[model samples]
Target: MSKLSLAETAELSMLLEVSANIKPGNIDRFHDYEDTKFRHFLASAVLARDVFERVPQMTLGEAMYAAVEHTNGHTGGNTHFGAFILLLPLIKGKGIAGACEAVLRTTVEDAVRFYQAFGKTQVRVNREDEMDVNDPASITMLREKQMTMLDVMRYSSETDMVAREWTNGFALTRKAADILKEKDGADQIQEMFLRLMAAYPDTFIAKKFGYARAVSVMERAQLVRAGGLSLSRFDEECILGGVNPGSLADICIAGIFTALLEGWQWDC
Candidate 1:
């Protein structure tokens, strides 16, 4: 009785049709197919879920849409296979019923939109053509360019109190703090941050996302002797002074791990 999200259900229905034994438009053979055919289809469907998750920028919805748009194209075939891999994890975590529905709903909408774009009547057709949306190289380009949505999502979902404190310490704007609150917001900010980091890896962006700062003997003494360095101290001395984040990796690491240790879990 695991609850399924709206998206997961949509994916499954398309999967059933896509993996069928009978050819397209062959209604009778498809209908009369043995129960075993369906059972196996169910199994393959599970595999597809796992595939979707591992794909870099593509979420289940994006991948499913890609599948419907270009099922015959090389990219579409990649998505088809990717969908199978995504199914396993979804099934184990969410029950079969819920997951299937999400999958079906997501995929069906994409199927319709794909047909409408070309002035064609929407059907359960697999076009498999080469569209920019279906480009297999999109994933590679994202990674090489360091602009992955997956990474954005992960950073957004995984960021915690310590990370927040760190950002606040850096004197991030109030809007920036709010942006870090949820996954979508975090993803948006992270995307921008990634670009900043790529351009200025030796600066603030890299420090926040990638590294830590070390406690100096004098800095440690201040903590022990005068109640630790406040984030304000770090902000005034570092942020305003334009000190690079790489120089503070140790401190950042300590703070991040401390926050994680305080108990954080991956987003659902």
Candidate 2:
């Protein structure tokens, strides 16, 4: 394998997270989500290579939304929405803080393109009283509000953990990276995943099954991880229960990418 740069490492880390069974509550080599299967994720990863490679030359929002569109065009499902959001600024030769700053600095054009990209990726986002991407007037309102991509994220940061990452400078992922750097090898992925899940209930689960169920999963993670308990049944139950801890998984991937970029060898 060739020596991967930070952007390349971050892109591959998403694929590695998707391929790892030990991450728990994720579709990996051992299990599959009913809607999104193994092939879909593999396809998503393959599609991401060009997007990741081209990101440096693109603006933050441009690269972010375009990658989402590109990935979903191939997979027909939300594949790397969170990864795309997180990796955009990182791949632009910015540190995590720089990435957050870039989000705040995005212009109305950036917001517009990202809004359009929503139609393509179709990532499951909260639309309670908010306008849908399909609503023709949404773009008009987007222009009216003169919102930046960061403004859009701020609108949803209250409930969406992924959005919070963008608005708050990816605090969780950064913290998890610190933990990952303290540890070593592939085991750190599982450890970081659990730590993240336990600390914060998975946003995907909360969106699907309400916040209480999400909290239960977090509690379960606490117990399962504390004693070094068997994760086999937990993994089985999470999948069977339709509990894909996607946000946590996404954050964990960020942590892994951080570790790899910082010269920690991933035990593949």
Candidate 3:
């Protein structure tokens, strides 16, 4: 855990590379991509049973349980150590723990990249002169509220500065969630999507399904809110089936909550 394996390092490296080139409009797309990647990883884990069949002493369940618990902050709960023992054979050629670490580390990198990219897009700085003001000392003062276009105009800043000013202080995660929580959040989130579909009206269409599937999950878990949203049921099913949740942001938020609940303190 102290030394990230090659795969883990590669995943983090990819994240850092993407962070440098992030743009405002790419945030959502990036999140969607990460979510897909994570789901794929989980699926792979569940489907690798054949590879472990030859290892008589290895236990896949124990290994997977350990990986999930370690991530979920349930430290020392080797309840399923047998599964990991079973998985030992699959990773035998590549060090079972190392491979598992790599997969988990990749998830961590995706989480970082998703948020960092969002943060980068929110802030912009165009001119050389504005570079001086981009210092952490100055930026910290602005990370509070939404920097509006009008506010940028008043500052006489460069186009980049205006963009940066508008987003420099933006908190993408909270803002995205808030956007959903607000009176028109869902409509707004769905609106852009609808508009896009309208523009391509002749595209392949699917039957419209109500939120019935989602609602059922919320109801069974007693997580329904008068106004709040819950994916508890969906998430539970996904977890049991080794599937990813609806979005990267959702997965990241789940990790955060798990970490928080398990008292795993981090600077974040």
Best by lDDT: 2
lDDT of 1 by residue, 161-250 (tens): 212222233222122223333333112332222222222222222323332322232233234335455433533454343342321221
Give per-residue CA lDDT, model 3, range 9-32, as digits (tens): 222322321231211112221322
Please give the TM-score that candidate 3 achieves against the real structure: 0.19
Instruction: After superposing candidate 2 on the true structure, give the runs of residues whose Cα lies further than 4 Å from its correct spot.
Output: none
lDDT by residue for model 2 (15-100), tens: 77877657677888777666778778888877777888887678776887768767775533787788777777666644676676
lDDT of 3: 0.28
Against the hidden reference, what TM-scores do the models get? 0.19, 0.92, 0.19
Candidate 3 deviation (Cα RMSD):
20.1
lDDT score, residue 1, model 1?
A: 36
- Model 3 — which ten-residue stretch has the worst lDDT? 200-209
Clash pairs, candidate 2, are none
Please report, as a residue range, the 10-residue window in candidate 2 with the lowest summed lDDT.
68-77
> For each candidate, how many residue pairs have backbone atoms clashing (under 3 Å)?
49, 0, 19
Global Cα RMSD, each model: 21.8, 1.9, 20.1
lDDT of candidate 2 at residue 196, scale 0 to 100: 82
